[model samples]
Target: MAGLELLSEQGFRLDGRRAGELRQLRARMGVFAQADGSAYLEQGNTKALAVVYGPHEVRGSRGKAGAAAGALVNCQYSLATFSTGERKRRPHGDRQGQELSLHLKQTFEAAILTQLYPRSQIDIYVQILQADGGNYCASVNAATLAVIDAGIPMRDYVCACSAGFIEDTPLADLNYVEETAGGPQLALALLPKSDQIALLEMNARLHEDHLERILQAASKACKDVHALLDQVVREHLQEVTALLGK
Candidate 1:
């Protein structure tokens, strides 16, 4: 909100992206052999790693003693000590982290076919390696890839993206600089194939009339991400099949 303008008059963002353009996306699946599944993803400058375990019996006192209906999903979200440039950082389990964890759990609950694993549980852990912005969106996307790596049945790929309205233009895939400018920010989690919404959250204030346009921009970005995820999953599966056949 200071000297830098969130959106330049030329319709370019601080990172040299068009108003509706997304940051460069780089991702890989099956990054951890020790876990049931894992993935690492980078969306712009924000990076995250996700690991999944279980779909076995639920664990700990928090879980029910006996098998219940549907699978339980537990998620832990953390920001690595050095994820942010600031030395004074919030540790794991901080209020923001906990809230984000719950958001992730809710997102997956809608996308995963939990009913198929009745009485079981799936644990997802995601750590933010870097935080330029869109942290939750990156984490959700990473978790979806990790879940897919575990060969879990899911209703659809859960793709997420963030958008903001600045300078009378809608911006997709916000970075830290735009985020701190304090415009009306919208975060969306989508089941792209079904055109269903898993989660949609907005912060700050925005006009009702402008909401639909911003949402449309975010949805388009999510669909684009879904296509990328599909490619990654297909490639990973092919490689695994080839190795297994050899």
Candidate 2:
């Protein structure tokens, strides 16, 4: 790819992962006692934290209620000033952050069964501590675990992955270098068991012939992410159970 060193001669990616492999995923739910739900997740060097609150009565405007069936999902995505290699002046209110917040809201609104808690609001706040790449994916994955920890009912766990095409080869899980290389990049969020896509996005031009391969690669990567997330949730529950001696 132009301006990118996608694969080294050693057949390793910039992060040294074989094709179709994801970064190491580490996550913790209920990290904060104050928030109704909270989680911290690290995918390789990319780190993100999510806090969820409410499902209570609307806070600001009463007229904004679009549905009486359930709850309103409000999401705000922010990046820590030091999250990137170059420090950001503001945490949020930037164009990129605003767009990310909107995307997150849309993704969660699909997964969360909002109709169950009518007239209430669910706030999902995501903070990126480190941004190597795939910040949105990491945030969604972390938030899903947090929502589950809070015992919120949802359609399914939202697992996300980013894929890139390098030198005509579709690669799963793109890191910073691969992403910046300027090739077609695809981001997908899938409900693993259902094999349904909640969010599908792409940047740059990709041929139709490569679309299926790229989608398949992303889907498989999402499934792998789901497995890792499941393990994290189970481990957290085990710890909680041990503490309770149950």
**Considering every candidate listed, which one attains the maximal lDDT?**
1
TM-score of every model?
Answer: 0.96, 0.95
Clashes of each: 0, 3
Best by TM-score: 1
- Per-candidate Cα lDDT values, in order, are 0.92, 0.87
In terms of TM-score, how similar is model 1 to the real structure? 0.96
Instruction: Kindly report which residue stretches of model 2 are placed more than 4 angstroms away from their true locations once superposed.
Output: 1-4, 62-64
lDDT of 2 by residue, 1-246 (tens): 545567776668877798888999889988999988899999878899999887778777762567477788989999999888886498447998999899898899889999898888888999999999898899899899888877788998999999988877778878776777788999999999999888898988889999999999999999999999999989999999998995
Per-residue lDDT of model 1, residues 1-246, tens digit only: 568776678878888999888999989999999999999999999999999997988887566644477899999999998899887768658999999999999999999898888878999999999999999999999999999999898999999999999878889999998898987999999999899999999998899999999999999999999988899999989999999999
Candidate 1 at 222: error in angstroms?
A: 0.3
